[model samples]
Target: MRKWFGQSLRLGLAPDGLALVRTSIWPHERARLLAQARFKENNVEAALREAERMLADHEREGWALRVVLSDELVRLWQVAPPPGAARMADLEAACALRYRALFGASPAGWQVRADWSATRPFLASAVPQALLAQLQQAAAGSGFRLVEVAPQFVAALNQHRSMRRPGAWFGVVHGGVLSVAAFDGALLAAVRTAPIPEGADRDWLEGHVAREALRVGLGRPERLQVCGPAPKAWASSAGRLKFACTLFEDELDPLWPDSARLAMTGRAP
Candidate 1:
């Protein structure tokens, strides 16, 4: 008795290139590929053209569009409210001041999204306004409504929320950038991202993971789940840690972001 509606388009924009996927949640076909294309990041004109072409071809008047940008362009921060900040506006100002102090620049023209609670403070991601405007324009031009735009790590985290385990380490590697997140079953403890050196050895990755875990006061994880383009040898390395490790075997492709976004939302589009 599931009712499916309009088609959805998901796009991933990364430093290397842009990727697109289209899917529908109709009962007869819950999900199927419509069209996909890629373009190098340096060539903005070409990338825009490809996006427009794909959008024009598959978009219906009211279809939904979602976009995920590469983690490289997003800056994630964990902030606490300033002392005596009682109002939401005051808290936001405190966060902005802290951000300026940390990054040495004003956050003007940046879209800052936050997940916060009174006890936990804030976990926020700041993305450039120009990038969002570009995506918005593309969606509007294509006759589709842009519903969500987030960083890849955020989308991936949302996609795998159900799989998180207490005292576990989860890592996502995409485009040579590795994003590590730790959970304590109830709360997300830490998140960090770093670039993997070219031709990195197993020892290098293991050391990095251990260091990050320690930084987050995790000591060591009971389990590890890695997604995206990780080396095959990582399994043996992880085994040496005396912890359960799983490497997602699916090849990293353009469609992955779309799939993850869909998994996170559970919406037809």
Candidate 2:
């Protein structure tokens, strides 16, 4: 089980769109879609309009909102544990500093969110504060309170809680980017996101996977669970490395919204 972040409703923000869903934890209840809309990436006006439209369609008063942002807008990193940090603020500062050093960019207007539950605690995301503020304002105006903002990859992983196997690798290929996450039992071992080169072939995909696994010190995974569109020859290629590949056909759909809903309810998709 995961710690409660306090929200039963979710709004998924993608580089190209947005989606909203309400979830129920009751045995006999089911999750429902409230509203969804698409917009061009980096178009602030279009995003705002879609957000307004989604909020206007639902009676969201008193409903908690969890926003899962696209990986394109957030950066995830795995860093060493902070030394002698005694408070959350101190830890956050250290994380920010590390992020700045890694990316060579100012963290002044970036919101850092970390997860300290693993043996090698990591920063889950660093998102632009301005973007977050816009989302918050939109939710507030809609009579809903924004409770949490998370990365899309993290949300997608949360949806596979039941399928998580120790010493396994999981990948999601979406929006021309591939996100690979390694897990050992309930602890996240390593995570990486890389862009897929245009017209990449099966060999290139296999090589990329091998390199990522090496970077994470996993050597090779016995199993690789994958979602989203992938080359048809990927399974056979991975089999050469002794990895039993499993693809979740259902997860191949637009994932942002489904991941958001799963993140809120901790339910398998």
Candidate 3:
């Protein structure tokens, strides 16, 4: 999971805004969106200022925090394992080399995390070190502990990785961004993200799938599973999308639309 136990504050950072959620897994596995605050200005720097204020001292103590940054804030890619790879150094060098190619920048200012592999292509993500430092300082000053910080799509993938199939790709949509992981049989071939277009519908999704498949050098999938706060029209029975589309069934997506009246366990709150 998040490499930790017990409850923690879930901070969702997106371009639209930022949200602070209270998540608990001890007594019950549930999350409630406690508060959302707009940034003073229209950028991530403003969001950081708002977060610093939100974490100011004298109010809360001894809490752990997990900051989930959005796709627009971090970079993600798939790194193929090198041939005859027999050590971790090979994997690290491959990632570092790929980072320069993909980002055209040295990895000095970035902190990288990856699913290391010497036999198959694995996922890699990089986050800005400045962002982490600011959050960590604020949390520590407020008597809170910084437990884990991750990109939103990476977090989602880790949560539902077991559901991934051999041929069908997986996508996570949120805050007008779609993060896709395209696979070739059992190997992860590509990882990419695209912004959701305005007034997007089933037709748009078909086009998206076709384009992503071509870009990743894969055949069109017969079916795909997607999750997030997607449009309801995507689920319409009539004039269905070309491919078989299935909602990535999750505990929260089941009750997300009208969760106010129902609990995470399908009982009245």
Judging by lDDT against the true structure, name the best candidate: 3
What's every prediction's RMSD, in angstroms? Answer: 4.2, 5.5, 5.3
lDDT tens per residue, model 1, 45-75: 5655666777777766777788777676678
Model 3 per-residue lDDT tens digits across residues 1-269: 45445656766765446766666766566777655665434598877776777667223577777777877788898899899999999999999999999989878888999999999999999999998898899788887888888777777777667777656777777757777888888788998788889999888888988999998888887667676766666653665646676666555534342211111211112
Quick one: how many clashes does candidate 2 have? 0
* TM-score, per-candidate, Cα-based: 0.79, 0.74, 0.84
Candidate 2 minimal-lDDT segment of 10 residues: 258-267
lDDT of every predicted structure (CA atoms): 0.68, 0.67, 0.72
TM-score of candidate 3 to 2 decimals? 0.84
Clashes of each: 0, 0, 0
Model 1, TM vs. native: 0.79
Q: Which stretches of candidate 1 lie over 4 Å from their true place?
A: 1-6, 26-46, 82-86, 183-189, 199-201, 214-218, 236-239, 249-269
Candidate 3, superposed: residue stretches over 4 Å from native: 1-6, 26-30, 236-241, 249-269
Best by TM-score: 3
Please give the lDDT score at residue 236 for candidate 1: 57
Winner on TM-score between 1 and 3 is 3
